[model samples]
Every structure is written in C-alpha cells, then in structure tokens.
Target: MLTAAAHLGACAGGDPGVGSTNPFESQGNSNSMSGTTQPGSDTDSTPTVGGSMTDSDTSTPTGPGPGSDSDPTGSDPTGGPTTAGTTTLPDPDCVDDDGDLHGEGCNAGPDCDDTSFNSWQSCGTCVDQDGDGFWVGCDQYGPDEPGPDCDDANPDASDGSDCECAVTPDAKASDTCAEGMAGALGVIAEGGVVPPIKGSITGIDNGPGNGQEDWYWVEFPEAMAMGNRPNAGKIAATFAVNPGDPTSPDYRFEVYTACNKPAFEGLAATYGPGTPPAREWEFFDAHSPPNPNPNPNPNYLNNVPWPAKVFIRVIRVANDQSCSEYTLQVSRLPT
Candidate 1:
C-alpha cells in the first residue's frame, strides 16, 4: 500500500490535469482517474477554471486605436483625420487708392492720370479748351492749315489770324496807323524808348510815272535822346522783299530831320538805284542831311545834335507796278 501511494504521488506530480490553475503545469495521463462520477453534476470532484485570461498581444490595429475614432484628442469621428489650420487670400487684380475700377503705372489696371478721378482712361482723347479744333499741347496731330494755336487760352489768338500784339487788324500792311499798330513804335512819350521797331510795307503801289511811297513819323523827345550831338544819332535799317509778284521793285529809303509833309512826289536824300533794291541801308547823324552817307571812317565820331523829329520814307522807283510787300526793321546804333 505504501508503494502504491508513492506511485500515485509521482503520477500527480509528473502529469498536469486538463482543468488546472496553472496552464504551464504538465498534463496528467489519460488512464489515471480520481473522483468525478457524473457529467454536469454540481458536486463532481474536479477543478473548474474560471478566471480571465492574460492578454499578451500589444500591437495596435491599423483601423482604429487610442487617440483614434474612440478618443476625442485623435481624429474626428464624423470625418477623417484632423487637418491643420487654414488661411484666406486676397484678390490679385484689385488696385488704386480712390477705389475706382482703374489704376496706373505698375498696377494691373487702366487708369491714366490716376490722381484725378475725372481723368480715368481719358488719355486717348485730349482736352481742348478754346475749341479751335485743336487740343492744347496736342496740335501736332491736327491739319497744317491752322497749324497749332499759339495761345489756347485766348480764342482771338488762333492759327487762322496773325495773333501779333494781341490784336487782329495789326497784321495787315495798310493798317499802319497807331490804332492798328500792335507793338512799340519808338515813340519817346509812350514810356521807355525801346529801340528796334519792326514794321511791314505792303499794298504800296508805284505812281503812274514813279511809284507809291509810305511815311512813318518818329518823334524823339529831348529827355529820351539816346546820343549826344550830330554823331550821336545812328539809324541801322534792313528791308527784305517778300518772295513772289512782279520783279522786286527798285526800292529806296530816305531819313529827313525836317518835319516836311510835302506831296509824295520828289523827296531828297533818297538812297537807291541798285537792282532788286538794297537789302540793308544805314543813316548816321554825323553825315549831312538829305542823303546822309554812311560814315566811312570807323575812328571818326560826330558830335552833331540829333533831330528831335524824323520821317522815314519808303518808295518804289518803278512806274506802272503793282503793290509790293517788304519788311522794315529800324534800330538805333550806339553813339
């Protein structure tokens, strides 16, 4: 009996039971039997394994895990994974400070003269204030007939009329009187005595036998006298005949110190006789009156008193000739 008891102890220690508390224990032999007499009996002599199993699998699943669908800190359940914060952008084509639809310079808009709201996209057409069919500073694009308006501010001074002296009638040759004169005529009483008076000689016809003549009266005041005596007065004059018309008339010029208004017939001190007329003529107070010869000696200086009043006469030497036009420039020389 002791030997049999020893054998049972060895078998129990070597073989593990099917329902044992430790899973690592060895299994017992199938032939060996203990007590359990009936199946599904509450009082059966057998160990019942009832505790929970220890889980060793620690790998997270690809679908969902902590901080995933179940966790609030993970991705949103309604959507997919959470995204980073977003930012808004501005329009690329908008420009200009006035808020107008146009802009200028480097911007991507069409505003010329962006400073002025009224001039947006208006550079293609210019502004004409005077309404002479030509815009100010834009005359080069118009017809040459009326060229460019010299003064757009004044309508009277346009390209169609001679806008000289700011008057209309002063451009004609027949209008030589003071009322029609546009500029200074060297009259001493009319303020400062500015020299170099310019005038035109036109519409003057030669008489039936000789030719027609025009007279200009110049009064020099004693206070405004330029030179001292006889040598003090010097007249340098130039006459340029306008191109066209019958052969340029044989023109002559004469300066008289006396106030003689004799008929336009024979006048003394006349200088002419050259073909096509002399383009330039000069008179010196040092020489004798009535055809005063130009002073030949440069060193010689005359002290003769200059006449207070003088008459400048321009005449055509030929007869039966039509009217001729010429420009006369008279200037005073230094004494």
Candidate 2:
C-alpha cells in the first residue's frame, strides 16, 4: 500500500491534496504544501507563501479591499464618489428694475425715479406741487408758460400778472356803444391821495376822417380847480389804432369846457367860476382859441401847459381812417 500511495503522490503532480492524502510518499512527492489555504481560513484569500504580491492584472478591482492604495474605478487621485445640491439662495429683493422688466437691483438699473410707484417704468416723474386745479402730470405747461412760481402764496399769480405794486382809491369812466371813452384823466396822491380807478383802455374806431366822431373826456373827484387839487398827481391811459399813413388823415386833439352838462353831473354844476362866464373854454387842438400845433401856432406849447384842468377831444380828417397806435401809460408829473 505504501508503494502504491507513493506512486499516486508522484502521479498527482506534487499537489497538496495528493501529498496530504498519503504522508508516506517519497520525499520528492511529499515536498508539496500541507493545505492550499492558510491555517485559519478555508479560502486562499491571503497572499500565497513564497509568492511576490505584485498586482496581477492592471484592470480595476470590483469592490473595497485592504492594502490597495489605488481606486478600483478610476486612476485619478480624487476619484471618490460625489454628491450634489443647490449652491445659492434666491434674492427676495430682485425685481424688474431697468423698466425693461428684467430682474435687477433697485439702484443698479435704469429705474430713475424708483421711489415712486408709477415712476418705476422710466420716463419722467409726474408730480404736481401746486394745487391750482390744473393737472400737470408728466407733461409741461403752455409753450411760453412755465411751472408755477411763488407756489406757497398765490399760484394763479405765479403766471407773472401780479408783479406790479398796488394802488388805492382809483377812478374809472364808461360810455355806451354810441359814444364811449375807454379811459379818463384824474389826479392821484401818494399816501392820502387816491389813484384813478382801474379801467380797460382802448383806441376809438380807426379814423383818417369821415366824421368818425370820437369824444375824449376827463373827471375830477369834487370838480375842484388846479389850485385846490392835491400837489401829488399822475395820469394813466391806454390807446389803440394808429395812423399808418400820416398824410392820409389829418388828426388833432382839442380841449374845451364841458358843453352844457355831462350825464353824471347835472346842469347846475356845468361851468367853471370866473368873469363873463366865471371860466372860459380852452382848446388843445391846432385850431380855434389859438391852434396848439407848433407849425400853425408857435404859442401852442404855452396854451395848456402841464398840470391844467380841461376837457379834451380827438379829431381826425382825411381820405382814409387815421390814428397813431399807442400803449397805455401811467406817469407822475412835476407839479
């Protein structure tokens, strides 16, 4: 049997199984290891005895293992598994700021007047500071007219009409369509004196001649003479329709004692106080009583000097209508 076992061990190719099955085999056959696995385990997972532990295959390993520094799946040093999630937070204040409806910060975009709710869309900011009952929303006032000035006080006055100073106790005159005068002459005082009433002044019908018949008149507070009139006095009046052609219509102005009586004062107080009639009539025209025009009468200047009380009238005579256009004037004279 021993001889037979030796033959079997020698025929088993020196494997551990054949060697372990017959220990009496020849020394050459008994050279095989006792067991293929280590003494503690049934598997040969550990490195083989007398075997160099060089990596057998270059292919990646399947799972986690010991003693291996390289990763199974990849050759990179940072080849670990990775996880992912949101990296940033949404901004609550972001909105369409540029008026273009794109999300952006308040001051970063084209929102000029962003503080205003409606102004966020760009354009101009519509705000009306004055309460003039006028709605100036985003738009401007009239072409020549600008925004309201002196907004704190009178807004209507901001338009520029209330620039001049004020006057007290003024006088005014009026007449019907048949015969009417736009303005009247009167005396005014500084502190105690009253100014002429404020009234609209306009020139009579265009006249070169043709008996247009425009009457000019004046008024006195109590019908007093120049001596009794106050020391401080001024005249204010406005005129229209100027004679474009001087030669066309011969024009002149005249002054005379009021004939008979005016509708305002009764016939009782019509005449001035003097001799043959208490007071005599005077003319400011270039003719009669001594023509006032320098060409016709050199003494015209001396006739009705400044600061004189008189009734005046304007006359025109020519082939066409005639009168020089003039603006309203208010001035004080040296008494």
| Best-matching candidate per TM-score | 1
Supply the global lDDT for candidate 1: 0.36
Q: List CA RMSD, all candidates.
A: 56.7, 55.8
For each candidate, what TM-score against the reference?
A: 0.29, 0.21
- Tell me the whole-model lDDT of each prediction, alpha carbons only: 0.36, 0.28
Top lDDT: which candidate number?
Answer: 1
Runs of candidate 1 with Cα error greater than 4 angstroms are 1-184, 188-211, 225-227, 230-233, 240-250, 259-281, 285-305, 318-324
lDDT of 2 by residue, 1-335 (tens): 11100000001112233323322122232311111111111111111111123333334435456887656654335544433323332333556532322235523334444333333332343433455533223222333324423221234534435423232112233231122344355443322222322322122324322333333455433233233223223332222232322212123332334434331111111212211110012212222333222544332222222223334333332212111222222233223
lDDT string, candidate 1, 19-81, tens digits: 644312322332121111011111111112112334333332245555653544344565355
Cα shift from native, residue 28, model 2 (Å): 99
Backbone steric clashes in candidate 2, count: 19
